[model samples]
Target: MAIPTPGQPVRGSRSGAPIMALFDLLGRRWGMGILWHLSQGPCSFRELQQRCETISPTILNRRLKELREALFIERCDKGYCLTPLGSDLQKLLVPLGAFSRTWAEVLPHEEASS
Candidate 1:
């Protein structure tokens, strides 16, 4: 794949706002975790918080609301779940997970003395 030349924009992107916009939205607090949690199935906010394990309720609520507005997530009888686009985003996270596992495996760790 060719890298975008310096000072030149990539195809179809004007100033990279579109891509940055997605990250700006999702890079906030629980945004990515919310997407990850919803991948299993629809769930309520409480459950979502539990799964994330670290997100504060306030932050989680904010991210979920933002995602819902972006049409990446939805709320229903199930409480919260990914919208169709959100489902697609879930598929995208798979490779990142694999990369993380591979990276952890190659890193050095402390040895326990016998």
Candidate 2:
């Protein structure tokens, strides 16, 4: 979770934060990657790190903190899992991720491989 400063809210209602706030909160360095990895299932911090291809401890920690405060995730005995809102977000992202993958497959990188 983001380190909530005194006199500042950790997060506000969806209407309260702007689109940029949502993007800025989750699109920060390694932020989406953390969420994407966790989307599969809850995993320990170390497991999450490994799944994220060894994102630096500092950045991973920061993203986790931000995600927590945003109410997009929760920590459990198993590890971190998406909140109800977050699961909704994940559902939304699935198509985006599919598009990204298919788009990339059409790029020169794939052409070069084949």
lDDT of 1 at 94: 84
For candidate 1, give the lDDT of residue 34.
Answer: 80
lDDT of candidate 2 over 1-114, digit per residue (tens): 444332343354334446546765765778777778889998898989899986998988778877888788999998888899888887877898889999998876834464
TM-score of candidate 1 to 2 decimals: 0.79
| Model 1 poorest ten-residue lDDT run | 1-10
Give the least accurate 10-residue stretch of model 2, judged by summed lDDT: 1-10
lDDT of each: 0.76, 0.76
TM-score list, all predictions: 0.79, 0.77
Clashing pairs in 1: none
Q: Would you list the clashing residue pairs of candidate 2?
A: 1-65, 2-65
Which whole-number lDDT from 0 to 100 does residue 49 have in model 1?
86
Q: In lDDT terms, how accurate is model 1?
A: 0.76
Q: What would the per-residue lDDT of candidate 1 be over residues 5-113, giving only the tens digit for each residue? A: 2233544455645665566566666678789878988888898888998889987877776777778888889898888898998899889999999988898865695
